[model samples]
Target chain A: MRTKYLVGFLVIMAAIAYLAWGGLGKSLVYYVLPSEYADNPQKYQGKRVRLGGLVKEGSVQFNPKTLQLKFIITDGVVEIPVEHEGTPPELFKDNQGVVVEGKFAGKVFHGDNLLIKHSESYKPPQQGAKLKPEEVRKLLEEAK
Target chain B: MGNSKRKLTDSLSSFLLLVGFLVFLIGQYLAFKAPPDVQQGYLVRILYVHVGAAWTAYLAFIVAAVYAILYLWKQNPSYDRLSAASAEIGLLFMALTLFGGMMWARPTWGVYWTWEPKLTTSAILTAFYVGYFLLRQAIEDPEFRAKAAAAAAILGVVNIPINYMSVYWWRSIHQTATFDIVNRKLHMDPSMVLPMLIDLAAINILFVAFLRMKGAIAARAAAREEIYD
Candidate 1:
């Protein structure tokens, strides 16, 4: 009975280990960096994939009337133009780390989802930093 | 077991439950009263429950692993009961952690589920404990069942460290730990610290209370089974 149980336990553990290893292997590259995607554009072209990088400074363009937001995602070495629909998350800002989920269309990556990659730090608003009246109204409207 | 001892444990369990519930209420009030985050704003409030539940789940699994070791070392049936009870509670809190995380993720991450390292490892952790119970149910002989479960419980704990470290080890979308236990540093604002600490304490107290209640019930069930035999 002891030997039988030992063998059974080993078999189960092996199976679980295999399953876990497979899961880790597949998702190890959760989002492809801009440089990696730039290395082989054909590999990700037309394929739905997540592209992660910092938003390029002074590159954000949002049209409230069209609900279209455009930005350039950069890894400092390479840059990819991203066009996302819908309002950006509250944390979204210039030079913010973002992960855009979509496919490449020509040189532009059309993103259906935009996610803000926030830092581990959580803080209240700074003493000197203040939101403009319109900005506060916009934020309140978005919160609703 | 002495009848007086049993009565004492029952009263202790009741007292802990009452205290745990009261602390939980206070913790919720503090969580709402805490200031909003500069980035996430009101959404950051979700972390009070999400992180607390996740921490408690990890605690439960580790406690289960320790009890499993005791059962194996001394061949104690009571230890086995306690180990199983702890794992059951761990599973419950793990569900809460996963569900609460999704609720937090939808508005923040733009997706309810993603195949990131932290999430994948957590899913694996949940699966192992679930299999632990399934294995327990499969065995017919009580002694053999205890022996096998003890082995599995010891092995299952390997996932806890892996799950906890997944964010730091991998390039995942999930944020790193706000309360870095290893570095002994907190990354939260001053206003939020008290509420977070209160939530953590409340959940931990509730976990201990639940463990005692569950263990006592398990002991009673074992006693009844033996009486029938």
Candidate 2:
């Protein structure tokens, strides 16, 4: 009976190893965005993936040699340089929100397909919008 | 039911589990490294392990549900053991599912956790099974344990369909099933799927093998205690 346990434990340990190691190669998800891809291009080049973030105001650059590209993607915190080889979306411009698909090749987005996303539009208060100062004044008068 | 029968079950489970784990390792080696995908590169390789674990876990849950029903109907302790074993294993792989998911999510979705249907429903199922285990822990009576677990098993099984339909039923962060686990996609590339299927089958057999081993042990312990009394 203990043999069953010994065997089961060994087997499960092996299975756990297999489960974690069974992939053809390492497939850890990237916690960092384009900037990381740039900082460590060697680590991320030629990987298949989908990356999401906003487009930088003016960082899209296309290279002729490898159909390569350079752009900046920001998560509102950090901006990452992106590179791709394919044609970009119509709205894919600096400062536009975007998600890029493709692999990284040394500090470039190597984007194969560009998916353009627009920020949600909110209407500003009407031009004639008024604020009642009476409530504020009453509170002030009470304080006095 | 007999001692010898129980012993046979134990031997079989251990042996099978060993074999299953080894095969899974082989599948991973073949699918992951040497021949990187020419198109999408290493990222495409994630499909192999991710899909394998997902399918294997699903199979375990279905098996647990079936065994749960059988145990309830027949009042068989063996059935209860099988149901319990399957649930335990199912919970483990379900965890793997969540881990693998986050690994993929950061790269694909650009976020670690999302309230997506597949992720959310999977999380809920994980919680449900945890509750099942907790329920078992609180109850000392085998009959009551089996009854409560069975009821929970049936009710909890609904989450599987909910998980599958999440992308369709609601806008979710998860992608739709482009390549079903069984059906091989041409673009998916044979180099990848080959090891995946093997790993999946290996895991399946291993799960059953484990179910039998642990189940038999529990069954025997309960029986021996009753005999002593």
Candidate 3:
């Protein structure tokens, strides 16, 4: 009886190991750089892929009414046009590292999800950029 | 002698527990008072607790692995109990880290969880410990159980460094280490450092306190079991 139970335990553990590794095998590369996709655009043409790069300067256009955001993501060598339908994260800005998950619609990448890839370094807002007490209160009031 | 030693440990653990909680409150105050991040604003505060819990979990797993090695070498039941206690606390802290991380991720990464390398490795690390407990539950014989558990504990520790280094080694959504120990450099700003350090100290002290208390309880249970046997 003990041997039987031990066998059952081993079998269950083996099954779990298989499933965990099998799932991980597919998503090993979390996101691909724009340059990487440019290298083999054929592979990711129809399939959904996470395109990651820095948001291009002076390319961001957001329509608050329609909730549509369009921007260009570039890796200095390759640039991909992105069309996302949602509010971007507060950290989202020009030259900011971003990952857009979606499929390509012809030339544009229609993003279903947008994420900010922030750096490890953090600093306080510069001296003049610091929010005044009155402005903080006004912002709080607006939030309310 | 044993009774005196037990009393000493009891007081020591209690002292640590008291200090840990007090310092945690102080850490929270400092974290809030610290200037908001240039990018993340208030969201950056979540990392103070998250990183602290993560580091404590790593420390606990390392301690468990060390105790497991000691238990195997000396064949000591006390060492096994201590190892088990440390692993248990480590698992609890790892859970906290995961929960806090998810909360941080939702706002920052736009997803609660992803199959990124750091998150995936952390999930694997947690699974190993869960398996450790399950293996412990399955074994009936005390000697066999301790031996198997010790081996598992030691083996499970192999994932710690891998999990910590996953962000650097692979393409990850998660940021790299704030405290880059390998290069002996702190990546974060000066103002942000003190509060995070305080949080780290608070969590580690609490881990030690909890381990001591849990170890004592396990020792008592073992003693009671011996009497019944």
Root-mean-square deviation of every model: 3.8, 20.2, 3.7
Ranking by lDDT: 3, 1, 2
Number of the top DockQ candidate: 3
State the displacement of the C-alpha of residue B214, model 3, in Å, after optimal TM-score superposition.
0.2
After superposing candidate 2 on the true structure, give the runs of residues whose Cα lies further than 4 Å from its correct spot: A1-144, B1-9, B37-40, B181-187, B227-229
* CAPRI category for model 3: acceptable
Q: What is the lDDT of residue A99 in candidate 1?
A: 89
Could you give candidate 3's per-residue lDDT for residues B112-149 as a string of tens digits?
98877888788878877877777777787988989999
- CAPRI rating of model 1: acceptable
Residue B215 error, candidate 3, Å: 0.3
Error of 1 at B54 (Å): 0.8
Q: What is the C-alpha lDDT of each candidate?
A: 0.87, 0.65, 0.88
Task: Rank the models by TM-score, top first.
Answer: 3, 1, 2
lDDT of 3: 0.88
Q: Model 1, B1-229: lDDT tens per residue? A: 4654556367777888888888888988988988888888899999998889999999999999999999999998999999999999999999999999999988887778887899989888887887788788777689899998988888888999998888888888899999998678899998888888888888898899999989988998888898899
Which window of 10 residues has the lowest lDDT sum in candidate 1 chain B? B1-10
| iRMSD, model 2, in Å | 16.1
lDDT at A92 for candidate 2?
Answer: 54
TM values, all candidates:
0.88, 0.59, 0.90
Model 3 chain A lowest lDDT segment of ten:
A1-10
